[model samples]
Target: MKAIIVDDERLARKELASLLASHPEIEIVDEAANPDEAVEKIEKHDPDVVFLDIQMPGKTGFEMLEEMERVPQVIFTTAYDEFALKAFDYNALDYLLKPIQPERLTESLNKVTIKSAKSEGKDQKLSSKDQVFVKDGDKCWFVKLEEVRLFESDGNYIKVYFDKFKPMIHKSLNALDERLDDRHFFRASRKHIINLGWVESIDTWFNGGLLVQLKGGEKIEVSRRQSARFREMMSL
Candidate 1:
């Protein structure tokens, strides 16, 4: 995979680049000192991944991603642990604390390879058995699609509800909806998408909508426009 190392510290960038050199799959296309340079290099090279630093002179790494029209897989390399949660929230490929461990770097690279293989077919929707990498602050999880009960939109982010944790990801609900299998996941409303398998009960709600209670006891309202479709899908 084509890659780039972006960090304010020259030594940090060089060290990462040196480590990456051992991995034949990752080819270093370029390097950037800050977010602006990173953006320019990224756009020019269209690399498969970026080893990014959170703190920089101009814009932070997260800000850099927000500004990009298309974001590549990101592997965060930072000295601070505070940004770990936010890094995962963006569904980054991995988070490596500096100075990065060789074992951890290998694991992250493996994950990237797996992700690449899974996404080989552009039209293939993600299945319920598939695992998605999620990070919230310092917490991280490899959550299965089947365990996810709901996806709620919060501005530009999507709050994922699964098990007892609700971690937010930096992705649009609509974009996620397109990648999800319609047979297992349904768009309940403009702000929410729900996993059909987790539905515990259904009840009529106001405005011709329907209220769906998940196994976890969370109640989500299916919009009036989607109610009929939901019933049709659930009916035997």
Candidate 2:
């Protein structure tokens, strides 16, 4: 599995890399001494796993992860046991306290191996019907396919509505549209995409547009351009 180590301390990075050398299955692709550099490396390489330090100079590991659209398997390595609880709260694979024991490191590496294999299969089968990892504030969920009601565009991000929460993901609505199944989802307007299954009612709106009401009580307006397709689908 391709991996990268992110730690502010240069010695920590070197130490982890040296220890990981014994595991031939893990290829050490790169290392970063700060969150900014790590972010750049992660974006450029897109490694399978990342050994991240919880507390860094500018950005914490959690802060860095928040910026990513799709996150890989993460194993947090930190000296403070105080953050261990918070570490796992984010669904991290493992948390190794420093100075990291060889046995502990080995166990974490094993977890990485298993998680990476699963992620590989998931990445290959990318579909809108597939589950996605989402986090908003202190809440997080692995949301399933059929539960999502709508996707609203918020500039560069998309707000995913599932269950009771609307989590913002760093992915464009247009990009998400390309991955979704057209039979199940429809681009109703420039700012909205509606799940056809969740649409509760439709009514004519002003200026040749149609207003769609969802089961969750959210309304989306279908533009004039898409009203013809919407009419054809709903025609008796």
Candidate 3:
């Protein structure tokens, strides 16, 4: 797997790079001294995983992740053990303390290998040209992804909206979101994922949020937290 190491200390970066050299599966793609440099390298390289330093000169590791368009697997390397709990909140691959032991590094590499294998076994994200098999009761249809306008969460099932056919699929909205291409399908809120191509109009909503009107006359409220990201994605 391709990886990048980010740390302010030159010696620390060298030490980690030397240790990682022993592992054949990991290729050190690049290194950065601070979060700004890290972000630039990460965007350019698009590495599979990043060995990140939580405490940086400018932005914290978490803050940098928030600004990223696509986030790769993160393995935080830090001197402080106090940030351990918070590190797991980002679903990091592993948290390695400073002066990283060879054994600990091996364990983290193993986790990354397993995770990569699992991802490879799964199908790719649903694209605009792809067709999905949907069934409700005794009726079923092979629906194209572009034709689907919305996916609404209804308990454990997702209500798929198409041309006059609303079928319920036994899948969570979160699961569907992971499988759909972000360029087309957008998660506007907790309960809804709307097709950007189907959006007809947009207006300012309450609480600094925005209201999206779809082609089928459905209005969905984009949450305040996701509004900025949505605006960036849609270039609004």
lDDT tens digits, residues 82-197, model 2? 66765356444678898888888889888754332342332343344444557566545545557899999999888988877787877888877876777778889888988888
In the range 116-139, model 3's lDDT, one tens digit per residue, is: 322232355667765455646545
- Model 2 alpha-carbon miss at residue 152, Å: 3.4
Residue 139 CA error for candidate 3 (Å)?
Answer: 43
Task: Count backbone overlaps in model 2.
Answer: 0
> What's the CA error at residue 96 for candidate 1, in Å?
3.3
lDDT of 2 at 184: 76
Provide the overall lDDT of each model, using Cα atoms, as 2-decimal numbers: 0.82, 0.78, 0.80
Candidate 2, position 33, lDDT? 88
Candidate 3: C-alpha RMSD to true structure equals 14.8
Off by over 4 Å in 3: 113-191, 194-236
Candidate 1, 2-110: lDDT as tens digits: 8899999999988998898889989999999989989889767767778889888878776776565445677888898776765465445688999998899999888
For model 3, what is the C-alpha lDDT against the true structure? 0.80
lDDT of 1: 0.82
- Candidate 1: regions farther than 4 A off: 36-48, 65-73, 81-94, 101-104, 116-148, 153-159, 167-185, 200-209, 233-236
TM-scores for every predicted model: 0.62, 0.61, 0.53
lDDT of 3 at 124: 59
